[model samples]
Target: MMTRVVVIGAGPAGLVAAIRLAEGGARVALLNKGTGGLQLGQGTLDILGYGPDRVERPLDALAGFAEAHPGHPYGVLPADLVARSANYLRDLVGPALLVGDAASNLQLPTAVGAVRPTALASPSMTAGACVDGARFVIVGLRQLKDFYPELVVGNLVRTDLPGGGRLQARAAMLDLPAREGEIDSTGLTYARALDDPAYRKRFAQAVKAVVEPGETVGLPAVLGLDDHNAWSEVAEAIGAPVFEIPLPPPSVPGMRLNRALTARAKAAGVRVVPGSKVTGFRASGGAVDSVQLATAGGDRDFVADAFVLATGGFESGALTADSYHNVHESVFDLPLRRPEGHLVHGDYWGDPQPLFTIGVEVDEQMLVRHPGGDPVYTNLYAAGGILAGATRWQEKSGEGIAVASAVRAADSILAAAATATDQGAAS
Candidate 1:
């Protein structure tokens, strides 16, 4: 019989875990309460951007990073596993769609013109990698209210490029294809408009008119919605290298990535059940036998041989804090490892709050562990934001932790299944 696994949450960690399990010949069911947190991100995978300072080479810094932060998720995972996890995601998303390797971090510009270090980025944003003496023409759509080319340029011109030197930047505003009566639009709306070939051609012409010689074009990340080739097509039409600057929520690039991964999971024979919240579970013999999902009609039970919890941290309500400042894990009520004393500090921008680092403790195999150092449940594993100890926002290691931990959990389950099958054959 096929090994059955139930993965909770639909975020990057859960989705990747489900896909990996299915690929390992397990019947996987991915359950989620709603859309995952991908749409709220930049869609770039950041391994280790900063270790107090900017990290130029993430892979090279992994060992020291892990040693310095022994409580972090990377401490339990091998650096090679982290590298393999990133490669797996790059391959799964197709090399063309998701570019870059673990060799070094790309310095990409954000909407606010701040340079962010990321290990893997889409082709649409890779060209904008910050370099010394680089010239940029930031283009903004008049209809898109979210982006301001002037603001981006103003910040870029003031900020020094990584490694050394400075940047030369200018702002340009162009009207997106005129809407019937709409004056203001969103990133998604602009992306849909750019999906049309004629519209992209006209838009490219408008950009071309403003761009100067030897200048790379930077635009809000709204190149395309349904068309994955829209960015390349626009670049071709303009006869210049164009890159995208990620905006706030409702990010087009994030949506594109989420769509691609979800589709790939389906294609891998993973059963994806969205809007299904796991309310409870049935456990016995030191293992989780099944999980119950809240349904419209009634509570539904999903039986599985193993389970994975990647419901995320405070942002996703997987970890909650009470008025007294005591934190609790929502599902399974697992014990969380917290800081020594105060969770929060007075400085908002100085250092990450201790509260953000609180999460369930997991063993080397990604299985949730008891305070005494034993597995809480033999069949239950945890990954992603829920298995913390790192200040992800401060370190820029959220995506890396998610992918690496998910891969670890899935591989452990697969290895156990293979061993069981071999033993039965021998018997």
Candidate 2:
């Protein structure tokens, strides 16, 4: 009999876990409330962004991170597993990203022209890498709101280059081909326009006219919606290397990953249930027997051999706080580890913010546990931001934690299934 697993939350962690379990010969179902963090992120994998400062060799620096913060997800999880998960992501979302040279972080620029640390990025986004002999032309569309060419130019000119060389920077505005009397336009709107091959040709010409010879051109992440090769085709037509700079929240680059991964999951025979709100579960003995998801018709019950709670932290509303500010882990009602006394809520850079790390307490096998240290359910596990102890935004370790913890949970369930089969055969 195949091992059955239900993974809640459709973010990178949940998606990865579902795919991994199915690949491991398990029947899997991925349930989610809504489109997840990928829409809000750059869609690039950030392993460990700032280890106080930017990390060059991510794999090597993790050793120090583990030593410093023993209870942190990375600290407790095996380093080899983390590395393996990264490779899994790289392989799963092929062509949507350009993973940096092994063992090192991909230093890529953001929308603001300031570079940040990431593990892998699409080739278009990777063009922001400050390579030798690379001069930059930052182009902003006048139609595009929330994008300032001058501000981007100012930051790019003054910002530190990764390769430690002086390069010239210039800014230009592209009057992107658009219909007249258009009320408002967003990145997605612009991307749809570019999807028309004729419009894209005209758009590429406008960019080509402005770009100087041998200068790599940078633009907002609105390239194409249906076509993944829009940026590359434009680059080839314009005779310059064009790359995308990830914009503000509801990031386009992130959307690309979400679409690709969801498509892949469905193709792999994984049933993906969207808008699924997990209200509760039924437990028997020491394991979860069934999960309940609320619906307009009524509550639906799903029985599985193993379960994974990848419902993200507060930002995703998987974890909520009451009027008295007492935090609650909404699903499974698992015990959360938070500061006992007054939490440091100040906006200071180095202050220990208690709110960020309040999440489900889990044991080494990725199984949920009580505050006093007993497993809440042997078959129930957790992965991603819902597992406590690391401030992901500051550390830039969100993807790393999600992928690593997910792989951990999947492996644990597979091992448990194998053991059960062996015992049953002997009996």
Candidate 3:
């Protein structure tokens, strides 16, 4: 009999979980709200801290992990799988999706009108250049998003480049609006403009004009350089090396990757049901029995021997805690670990504390822990950004963490199921 697994959310964490589960021979169904964080589109993967010094290129770190964990879901069965996935993604969008060690040495054009060496996604890139002093200009889209040029500048200043030289930064706005021509002050609205070639051209030109002749411009990560040709063309025309930076969490690129993963999962025979909300779950003796889903078609019950929760942080709207400090597992009322505080720290970059304390706490096997520190459901597993301890932002290990957790969770799930079947047969 095939094991049926239902996964919540379609974000990177969710999609990756679904993919691994399905590949493990389970009938997997991925559910999402259709628009949970996909539009940000800053296409850089941050797998920070690997290799001898706990410092290596992002791609190299991922590649090394894939090589070491060949049987892992994120790991490629063959050595070329890593390159193949990278190449396929590069082909889909544009050539800017750089792979290999060379990326560290690659000179990138910046909005500031200067060029700089690209930084690995893991270790945070310090703002100032070691060589000639450079001016940094941050390009803001007039009506786009939550991106605050001043705030980014402040962060860069705070981080202080490796050298003592001061990194100067200024902000300029691009007058782009959302779908209906209405300007959204949040600035997140300009993300949609990337799909338009004309918009890209105009934005690139505007950025070029603002950059001081000798200075480097640090544009928001959404410059629409989705391909290599476009990246090069924009680089040549702008006459500045462009360094793509990772946007904040719930980022557009993170969302887009999730959507892509969902489509791929569906094509691979995984059932994807978006807009289906799970309201409650039925569990007995610490094991999930079934889940109640609220959909447009009405209430539907899904029974599965195993369940995977990918519903992300407080934003994804999956796990909610009550005033009494009781965390309710959205689907099954599964016991969850509640943090003492809503946030580990008030400041975004204040402390590099683990994010897991705020999320559902799980054991090493990726199984959610109950309030009493007991495994709630042996068959129920959680993975991705939802897992505790992973600070996607400060750690720069978002994608790698998500992929690695998914692989680990899938392995555990399969192993548990096999053990169950063996016990049943003996009985």
Candidate 4:
């Protein structure tokens, strides 16, 4: 019989775990509360960004990360797998995702114009990476509320590209299309408009007017939602390389990635149950017997041979705190890595906050463990932000930790199931 595996949380880690488990012949169910963290993310996969200072060589930094952050998720797993998983994700997402290699980092400009480093980025996000002697003309939609061309240009002007190149940035805006009032004029609305060839052509012309030859044109990430060819058409029309700078919240690129992964997961035979909030689980004898979630009808329980908890930390509500300041793991109420500060903190720019680093402690096999280093459940594993160590946002290793741990946990589950089958056969 195929192993029945349940992966909780629909973020990159959960999705990846479910997909891999299903592909490996396990019956997998992926559950999510809301859309997960994709929409709120910056859209690019940042394996590791800064290590005390900006990191030019990500793979090299990863080698030392285990030493500096001995309790980090990357530390528990082999360094080579962590490195390989980055490449694995780029391949898994397909070439269209346009990820860079682990050997180096991609330096892209943020919405505010400050240069940031990431290991993997979308094609549109990496378009203007040629910072050395690079000049930019940024375009914005007049009606879009969040994106500001002036802010992006101002921040970019102060930034010199990664490769010792001088930077020049200019700002421009396009008047809303005459029919723009018909829609809400949001980033999603703007992307749909650009999906139409006629509208895209006109918008391209507006951006082209501000850009000179050989200079890349940067625009908000609203090029197109489902239309992969939209960015190319605009670039072809403008006669220059066109790139997208991400917006603050509800990021378009991030949504696109989630959609892509979701589609692929569905195709791979993974059962995706969205909007299903897992409220609790039943455990016995150091193993999770079943998971319970609230349904429209009422609460439902699911039994599985193995479980992977990719439930995110504070942001996704997988981990919570009360007024008393005690942080609790929402699902199994598993022991946390650190008890006192379920959500403690330091100054934003000062030392790393103790709260973010506190999470479920896992063994090398990725199995969630008791505080005393005993496995809470031999068949229950945890990954992503819920797993302990490393300030992900500050270190910029969010995607790296999520994908690597998920993949590793899935592998361990499959191996354990196979061993069980062998033992049963001998009996």
lDDT of each: 0.89, 0.83, 0.56, 0.83
Candidate 2 per-residue C-alpha lDDT over 206-310 given as tens digits, one digit per residue, 9 for 90 to 100 = 999998887889889988866888988899899988988878977878888899889888888899999869999999899999999998899999899999999
Better of 1 and 2 by TM-score: 1
Residue pairs clashing, model 4: none
Model 1 lDDT per residue over 1-427, tens place = 5899999998889999999999999999999998997887788888999997999999889889989887889998777999999999999988656899876999998888888999999899998988888889999988887789988889888887778888889999986644556788888888888888888888889999998889999999999987989999989888899999999998888898899999999999999999877888889999999989998989999999899999999999999999889999987888888888899899988878889989989999999997538998999999898986898878999889999999999999999889888999999
| Candidate 4 per-residue C-alpha lDDT over 281-340 given as tens digits, one digit per residue, 9 for 90 to 100 | 888877889999899999998899999999899998888877877788988888888734
Write candidate 3's Cα lDDT for 1-427 as tens digits.
5788888777656766677678778898777766544343234443543332233344555556546532222332222333343333333323234343322433333223233233322111233232325566766666655566666665554443433454566666666554556766432344455546676676678778877776665555553422224444455667776544445544544444544555668776789877768877888876888888888778788888888887776556566656655555565555555445554456764554433445566666777776447787777888766665444554445555555566666777888877778989999
Worst 10-residue lDDT window, candidate 4? 176-185
Task: List CA RMSD, all candidates.
Answer: 1.2, 1.7, 7.3, 1.8
Model 4 per-residue lDDT at 232:
83
Clashes per candidate (backbone, < 3 Å) = 0, 1, 33, 0
Models 1 onward score TM values of 0.98, 0.96, 0.67, 0.95
Clashing pairs in 1: none
- What is the overall TM-score of model 1 with all chains considered together? 0.98
**Predicted structure 2, TM vs. truth:** 0.96
Error of 1 at 420 (Å): 1.4
Error of 2 at 49 (Å): 1.1
**Among these predicted structures, which one has the highest TM-score?**
1
**Positional deviation of 41 in candidate 2, in angstroms?**
0.8
